[model samples]
Target: MDIDARTLRTFREVTLTGSFTQAARRLGYSQSSVTAQMRALERQVGEPVFERLPNGVRLTHSGIVLRDYARQILTLVGEMETALRRPAANPPRLTVGIVPALAYGQQLARVTHIGRRLLSGVQLALRIMGTAEVHDAFKAGAIDGALVLTVVDADDPADLLGEQQYADRSDDLTEVRLQEVEFVPVTGVGRRPGGHGRQVVIADPDCPSQRWLPEFLRLRCDSPPEIHELGSMAGVRAATQSGLGCAMLPTALAADHEEAGGLRPLPGVPRMRWNASLILGRHDTRPAVDRQNLTETLRQATALGRAARPAVPAAEVLGGAGLGGEVLGGGATALDPDTSIAS
Candidate 1:
């Protein structure tokens, strides 16, 4: 309706106050100016916008709809004004969506530390979300980059994590594989390390290992086993500690528990793999300095746990095929470590 910012401002103030005199006073305008603007607004809308009672005013149904649209229009106008007038004054801001695996661990801390060092005067915002949320942020242009963890095969990198799963990879995004965290199946101490009696505890839905673990476990059982869907790795670890189910975790995260006699390794089931990657938008408007620093931050952080872990080959894990072939009912099959770490 060709309304100007001033008129919209007047309309907004009047809606807030529900009184022409109050709105005019709040806006530093005469009541006649407020009335003139409202009359003009009604003419543009071809409907009465307000019912003027003796005490105050009330919005018509049309005015309510216009109020909704006016709020959106005003917001966009404010953003445009800000962008045009103070583009250079904006801080080197980075909005990142990170999986809980990295967000809750030292890896994320390392990233922020390095990010501050590399991109001085940087406004770094870290969002702890799932793979799906990370993808959504990227799609919405709400985030500049992301730290994500996904599952893959050790022997065949492209074998796909379970059939028809979008949890591991997004087709259109750029995923920079940072490091291969060692994956080991763990059960509570003295619990059946392999299938059958063991319930499987997995990271939240869309977690890197969430789908892959269930598929591997079902291979050992005739039907789908009992599954606990935890929303975070800490929950998964806590559940594992309680001897609720078997979980495949990065050795770095599970090593201490295994060593402390609270958890033990499960062997014979195929060793799963996880890919810890930094996902960035293909089209980035970030300053070159900010983008480079973010990439470095993710790279350094993903390496946090991989370096300290001791490597255990497939053969050493319960003879590489369970204590006996009892779990899988197959001959000695050694599953190797090929995973990415996260809390």
Candidate 2:
């Protein structure tokens, strides 16, 4: 079917908001007009796109299928527009995939540094996705590079495909250790003393913490504590602040919430360390000058992360294989003194 850009845009809006009325308000169209547009698009595609349920309007299976293609088409269109407007002297674009957990202050600082210095005229697209999705995207050539946490053993074959690190490894990629933040269990401020009864909220099962937390809890607690699986750190913090339960969160996040009187760390819980890393494919053919400039920008960004309180260890921030056999490179040089913080 030949769906126009306008129709696809409407469909996307409705899909995101899950309400035709809300989408209409955002799009500045009458509800009737929005409904008519969706109906017309459905007719063109010869299928029912949405099904109204008690909670909200949901995409039908057909709608779900079309949405993927629509996103790709829109992305291509955006790329075309950018290419047409870009200056001839500008460097080629660098597409970087990052995990959703890394989309915060320190990460923003790095992106800003890159934008101002190394990536001056170059387009730097930061795509937020899950760690697994980031790895898949890198392998599929959907992104030129990424910044994500490493979970699999350093010696695993997948780990060696990019650059390699103990905590955050990849094979043929340039690796930079960002920061080693620790997670701690936290609860609402001024709450009761019976901390044992408190529910423990966790991020989705896919998160590294979730995979490790069960084992830690099993060993530490007398019995299984109530568990709530949330999609984001914000949600977990919110739940804990409302006295819903205890949450294991990054020290940085817990500190922010504690300052706001929303939460406090549960005393006696051991902190667990996690690291972030930057990964770029070796086969990527971007210009040498551009790569050098980008690398410098990343270093500055990571340095900012290190400067934050609770100084992280440089050794903990690695770029080679772990006990497993993931080799970073045959003769890759260590990070320079100017860029890397001393372990």
The numbered model that scores best in TM-score is 1
Q: Can you write out model 1's per-residue Cα lDDT over 1-343, one digit (the tens) per residue?
A: 7889779878977886679998786556999999999999999999998988898999999999998898678656654544554446667678888776555455567778766655556678898887667666777878888777654323232322222443345444555556666566777775542332347887656665565566555543435668887767778878888878878776677777778888777654544446666677656666543554466567666777663433333224322344323322123343333321110
RMSD of 2: 21.7
- How many clashing pairs does model 1 include? 2
lDDT of each: 0.64, 0.60
Q: Candidate 2: worst 10 consecutive residues by lDDT?
A: 334-343
TM-score per model over all chains = 0.58, 0.53
Q: Judge candidate 2 at residue 261 and give its lDDT.
A: 88
Instruction: State the TM-score for model 1.
Output: 0.58
Which candidate tops lDDT?
A: 1
Error of 1 at 205 (Å): 2.5
Tens digit per residue, CA lDDT, model 2, 108-226:
66676655544556778777666556666876888987766544334353443223332253444545444455555677886566553346776645456444444344434435666
